[model samples]
Target: MHIETQLAQHRVTGLRAQADAHRLSTEAKPPVELRTRVGWTLVELGLRLASAPGPAPAVA
Candidate 1:
């Protein structure tokens, strides 16, 4: 749980850095930053799936 919170904070920090860098430049975002963004999005998606409700019981 502590590690999870740290990871979430790191994701927030990374995204803010990317946004600030982009705002300062005309060129498109770097590939690494793009990949990082995708990775974080996937991580959040997986976490949501992990915490979701289980399936209903089957009929007899």
Candidate 2:
């Protein structure tokens, strides 16, 4: 199923925050790199959680 618009907005906001954080960094790492890393990290976590087993059926 597709993510809701609100959820998509939230994700976009989070990514912007992450990008901003990297933008403030004085290190050699670039903002684009930070954005990609953070985005991929979120995707990886989501995938892992989605793959996790959930509750099974109860007795009839």
Candidate 3:
């Protein structure tokens, strides 16, 4: 299955997937290394989500 379809089926997306965008961030950590990785993952996911089209409109 395609990624877009997979995302839809799994119900995983940046839009509804995360209740709070803030949740995606890495809380202040002793070292910056952890933050860097979290940031990268967020960015990667954001790009994929952005590229995907929104769900189809509900029929009347």
Candidate 4:
């Protein structure tokens, strides 16, 4: 039973290492094109501007 637990733990550790490596490899290179990046940036800017509060009314 102890040996089985150790083996299972080792397997889980290896799998976690493999997943971390895969995540790091994928993150190392972004898949977005320049056009896509620019588009998303514009979309975000538009959203921010749209949601911004307008100027206050003048007090007479």
- Best-fitting candidate, scored by lDDT: 4
Candidates 3 and 4 compared: the better one by lDDT is: 4
Error of 3 at 44 (Å): 0.5
TM-score of every candidate relative to the true structure: 0.41, 0.42, 0.37, 0.54
Candidate with more favorable, higher lDDT: 1 or 3: 1
lDDT of 4 by residue, 3-49 (tens): 99999999999999999999999999878899999999999999999
lDDT (Cα, tens digit) per residue for candidate 2, span 1-60: 356988999999999999988877757654578888899999999999999998997989
* Candidate 1 wrongly placed segments (more than 4 Å): 1-32
Candidate closer to the true structure by lDDT (higher is better), 1 or 4: 4
**Comparing 1 and 4 on TM-score, the stronger one:** 4
Candidate 3 lDDT tens digits, 1-60: 899898886775665566455555545435569889999999999999999999999999
What would the TM-score be for candidate 4 when compared with the true structure? 0.54
Scored by CA lDDT, what does every candidate get? 0.90, 0.87, 0.77, 0.97
Task: Mark the 10 consecutive residues where model 4 has the least summed lDDT.
Answer: 23-32
lDDT comparison, 2 vs 3, better candidate:
2
Clashes of each: 0, 0, 0, 0
Query: Which stretches in model 4 have alpha-carbon errors above 4 Å?
Result: 1-18, 21-30
Where model 2 places Cα greater than 4 Å from the true spot, the runs are 1-32
Work out candidate 1's RMSD over C-alphas.
14.6
